[model samples]
Target chain A: MRHSLTLRIGPATFRIGSAWAQPIDQLARLYADYPDVDGAIADFTVRLQPTSAVRRWVRPSIFITGDHGLADAAPMSLAHGLLAAEMGMNLQMALGWRRHLLLHASSVEKDGRVLVMTGESGSGKSTLAAQLGERGWRLMGDEFALLDLDSGAILPFPRLVSLKNKAIDVIAGEVPAARMGPLLGATAKGDIRHMVPRADAVARMGEGGMPALLLFPRFGSGPAERPVGQGEVFMRLTQASTNYVALGEPGFAALTRFVAQVPARAIDFPSGEAAIAMVDRLWSEIA
Target chain B: MSAALLVMALRDPATTAALDATGWNSLIAMARAERLIGTLAFRLEGLGVPDAVRPILADTRDDAAREARQAIWEADRARAALAPIGLPVILLKGTAYAAAGLPAGRGRFIGDLDILVPRDRIDAAADALVAAGWEWVKEDPYDDAYYRQWMHELPPMIHAERDRMIDVHHTVLPLTARPTPDAAAMMADAVLITDGLYMLCAEDRVCHAAAHLLADGDLQGGLRNLWDIHCLCEESSERQDDFYLCLFEKAAHHQLTAAVWRALRLSHHLFDTEVKAYHVPIEVDYKLRWSDRAFISRLLARNGWGQETRKALVFAFFVRSHWLRMPPLMLARHLLTKWRKGHRPQ
Candidate 1:
């Protein structure tokens, strides 16, 4: 690696190395508010390497790799280097992290309790989490939600909330310009911009909140809510977790305990405002 | 170069206690690259590690345990699938290690299940497996024809429901390879492991691993393959008297004397495996042979970052693999076909 940077994201620190300086520079700008953990050993390392020697000069492809790698990962052009770095970090956590049962969900903390939203890729969880972050809810995380195995608390991951397509202008309207990263246009996922959580979220990232609500949010639907069954929740969560099968017995035990304790629902919304109002009602109704 | 620390950690786990954060990080990366993290997890069990590194190993141990179970379950599925055919099924390599409860199976990560059948029985066994829900993984006609014509195993098959792969072989090495091990003799000596499962005899098992490591492939991921030989030899030699004697005799009968000897010398060199047998010495030579040193460098080509450092030597060994598999004329034709088909080095 010719360039490198180390920064702490909530409880985990990442040491990102790259064959080029542009990606690291972009990451530094996006995560400027995050604490610098220079000289600290990182839990994961992400490398943005060139696909080959020729590729470094011609077409300049980036192969994202680290402690763990997916063999079928296609190389990205130099334009998407930052996205590649983020994916590399996510890949390492998905494959290697074991201190927590990781859930592919977004979460926000309020009054010492947490609300977790999970669904498929286009589920609008990121938009809701980002929107609520400004409306008095401290955004916990927008990507992976780290669940403590023993305590069942949701530890904050606090990565930048990546907004895509229409969600960009929606959240960009609320946050100040300095709080948002540059618009990355025409990515594989189409037009992504990263929004940093408020300063309080970064400052209190170490705090863990008890999981009080679990909702499966679906976007582009009529406003409706229904209770999700225990069996369905268990199966869906196992699928949502990248390391559930790898954790084996402890994973089974932790998930079983979690499903028993937490009440879950599937909520449908036509817009973010409607979703937020329903979420507020749901939160107050629970205990 | 980073392989030094990795080899030390594998050969003697106690020395790893002195490793610092940097040392442990590099060691773990190298082990993962070698696909021996599970083996290292087992080796470092009960040993103290840094605060942060503990969960990594613990998680790896759990993952390896899951892999072992899945491997055995796949083997069981094959057993039940092929029972009606009435042909013997012999487990090979990692699957055999796990089924026979060998030391090599401890924390072994098996990717696919390998089994052997008689040459005449292979077609029936393959058909039976397909009937049992195993589908051909290779869609390329050339690859399929290549496997059926020149390879030891049929084109790899993955179970439709389980998503695991199983390889059916009539013998250990490819038919085009120099040595022609008597597949029937090996099948005859297959000891019954369970109701419908069998593995090669003790001597044949070790020899087959040696031949596979040396003759069958480029010593890519050679560390784990060598570790298998080390654990197998260490266990069998301690428990069974005359184990080395039988190993050597089988090696000669299978025409794998050179491959087996090279395996022993390399394993003893890299891992200090104890091979106390007549006429088989691991004494360091003041003058090392060219081939001997090439094999050593080829095995240690990977750096701590899991990157292959020695490109020239790596390519040489890759060609050396195809060279060992077939004669020059056939090798040229095969290489051309593969190259023209847009097969680039991964």
Candidate 2:
């Protein structure tokens, strides 16, 4: 690792070392507002390494590696180094983070209450979370909603909002040009651009709120809503979580608490505006 | 010389509680690299760690518990599946350790369920397993033929509903391997756990672990393999005064004297496992060989950063593993065949 940067992302601190300076430079710029992490022992380490020594200079590709890694993970071109760094950090958290009941969901905080949204790829959850951040909701996170095992509080991660394809334009419209990252063309998940959350999201990252609403949002359809059953919610959440199984009995207990306590709904929307409206309506109805 | 941080921790787990952040970091990384995080987790249980290290340790510990439970459940399912085969179903390796409540099984990660049947009964046993919903994971004809003809086990199979895997082995080593242990005699001496389930006796268990470590594989999970030998020897030696005498006798019978001897010395060197914990001189019994130092260096090839050092040594051992398994001609053919099949033997 010739170049390195360390930053605290909410509950976890990551030390990212890289073969090239580009990824570090991009990450330093994007995560400029993160907490001071000088000489901090990182919770996890991420390294952007070349697949081989000669390969480093040949094609100049990057293998996103860390404390935990997938042996057969494919490499990415240096052009998507920022995306690689993000993936590396996310990979570490997904595989290793255990203090929280981590869910593969986006969340937003309003009035010290949290609304978590989860869906499959292209379900507009990222777009919705990014949209809600500008339209009065404090974006808790756009990738993972960290639920404290003991407290049930939805801890704010709010790293970078990964806006793919059409969602890039949707988020780019609301945020200033400075907040938007460079466009990554033709990735595995199609076109992607990372957007920094609003300053408030970074400033109040330490603050966490009790989860009030859980929504399974689906894009493509015009606005429709259904109350999701608890059993269905539990099963879906288990599938959604990266470390639910790793957390074992405590994870089971925490998830059960979440399913029992939080009000859940499956939402459908054609666009970001409709999803936001549906979220607001559901939040109001929950109380 | 001081052992690697992970080895030191395994030797005395309480010592880690006093380590600074740097020490904990190195220890954790090494443990993870060696796939011994779960074992460390159990050892570090009840000891208070730094707040930062708590979650990491706890996480792996929980996961290890889940793994053990799932492994045991898989073993039970395997037992039920092979019940009607009308042959002895003896558990092997990790499943065996856990089934018999050995220290090696505590916090150990068991992957696929392994069972042994007599070489003659293997076909019937394999057929019964496939009938019992163990679907063929390796559907390729070459792999199937390779396993049936050259290897000791059937092509690896996965349970259709449970998604778990079971590798049914007639013996530990390939047919072409130089050392052909009497699998039938070993099976006859197997200790029964339940009505249908069985595990290897202490001496045979040590021999198998050593064979698997020094003779069978590329030392991929060598640290874990070494740990198994250490614990097995320590526990067995304590239970019986003439444990080493019996062990050596069995090792020679299995044609694994060199492997077992190197295994014992390496375990003693790394883990401080006492062959004379009961006050008998065991080191004096077997003279140290110069080649033992090469393996000692090879075994401790991991640096403080958990990175695997000694690439040449690694490659040499890999070649030796294959060399031990088959003659040069067959080895060349196998490697070429694997290369052509897109599973490059590396």
Clashing residue pairs in all predictions, respectively, total 0, 0
The residue-level lDDT of candidate 1 at A259 comes to 90
What C-alpha lDDT values do all the predictions have?
A: 0.87, 0.85
- Listed in order, each prediction's TM-score against the native is 0.95, 0.93
**Interface RMSD, all models, one decimal each?**
2.2, 2.4
For candidate 1, write residues A1-287 as lDDT tens digits: 67888878877777788889899999889888788776456677778899888898899999989878877789998888878888888898888888789999999999999999999888999999999999999999988898888888999999888899999999999999998887889988899888889999999999989998899999999799999999999999999999887777888888888899889989999999999999999999972
Residue A90: error of model 1 in Å? 1.0
True contacts kept of each: 0.25, 0.25
Task: Tell me the tens digit of each residue's lDDT in model 1 across B1-346.
Answer: 5577788898999998898766766687778888898999889999987777777788788888788888888999999988898876689999888888899999987989999988888889988999999999999899999999999989999999989999999999999999989888999998988868899988999889999999889899888888999999999999998787788789889999888888888888889988764634432222335787888888887775667778898888888889999999999898899999998765
Model 1 lDDT at residue A65: 91
Question: Would you list the clashing residue pairs of candidate 1?
Answer: none
Where model 2 places Cα greater than 4 Å from the true spot, the runs are B1-3, B14-18, B276-288, B303-306
